[model samples]
Target: MGTMVISGTVVLVVLGFGNHTWWLVAVAVLFLYMQYGRSGRVGRGASTSSPGGSGGGASGMTPGSYRAYRDRRDKQARWERRYRREHPMEARRQARERKS
Candidate 1:
């Protein structure tokens, strides 16, 4: 499949240089396909698999991105917990204000 795309693009590019400038249009479209097509399956990190999901339905999240997102959220939660624990008075004041 990779070879086919490269070969077709090369042919279109070569033809585009000649009188058939219209071939370049097809080449441009093909280039876009290659760009978007390859972007989704870049590396293992950009896997098609759903992360932390069931054996069904796609989560539409790459494992690497999900891991990074989860790590960031967990770190923030831990920091917030520590801050609240140390500042019980402030935490209670904020909680009370939020309830009203």
Candidate 2:
């Protein structure tokens, strides 16, 4: 199933990386499998099982969704901060648009 596909993809990526001596691809796949696959499943399950899923189904906002939203917001904020440092005037224009 999903595991088979993941394994096959990992094998292909590793084989492709063999041309170079880069072990990072293997490490990256391992990390992605461990953190993303498990946590994503758990998050999806939790969100679907929560209350107020009246009609929104999987797209409904739950604790898991809020956590994801907050995480995205924080990441966006970090990027915006960096962008502002690089282009202060553009950032100011964006802020003005938001105000309008």
Candidate 3:
């Protein structure tokens, strides 16, 4: 993590001062920063879980579950839309899926 930040900063500094085409360096730095943030290695060490289970990097909540969860959410959204259209009164009466 430290390595990533240091490398990214070095690249940025070089790009700011050097005459070479530093786009690649900038890209590399961005990639490293993203990697670092994704791994939760910035202020703290890499975590076993990410902000969302959708991130394809190394984390918990298997890739299959991520897809399944997304699909379920989409399906739920569709159902909500249909329910609202079919039964506007019920939709206005109470919220579906209570807040947890």
Candidate 4:
């Protein structure tokens, strides 16, 4: 599925270049970048483990690391909640300052 889409896009870009349509070539390059460049799945020097592999999940996060990440995020959330509850005025002031 993905291959077919990419192949079709490449064909279009090639055809555009053959016809000397500079704008089409530019648009094709931009489209390809928008489709693939911003996606986090394609990172340089990053290794992705296969299904049922020795380590890591589908998103390349290992169990221990995922747990630690979640714990840190939860702790931060709890601290923020407690801070907002205990220092509403300070929180509000900080928010206002950030907005400006």
Q: Where is model 4 poorest over a 10-residue stretch in terms of lDDT? A: 42-51
* Candidate 2, 20-93: lDDT as tens digits: 43355656666677655765653333554454446453345565566557767999999988999999999899
lDDT of 3 at 19: 53
Model 1 scores a TM of 0.38
Show model 2 residue runs off by greater than 4 Å. 1-64, 97-100
**Residue-level error in angstroms, candidate 3, position 88:** 0.4
Among all windows of 10 consecutive residues in model 1, the one with the lowest summed lDDT is 52-61
Q: Clashing residue pairs, candidate 4?
A: none
Q: lDDT tens string, model 4, 1-100? A: 5566566667767777668675476576666666666543443444444334566443565333555478679999999999999999999999999999
Alpha-carbon TM-score of each model against the true structure:
0.38, 0.31, 0.31, 0.37
Clashing pairs in 3: none
Top-TM-score candidate index: 1
| Structural RMSD, model 3 | 11.1
The candidate that wins on lDDT is 1
TM-score of the candidate numbered 3? 0.31
TM-score of 2: 0.31
Compared with the true structure, the alpha-carbon lDDT of candidate 3 equals 0.64
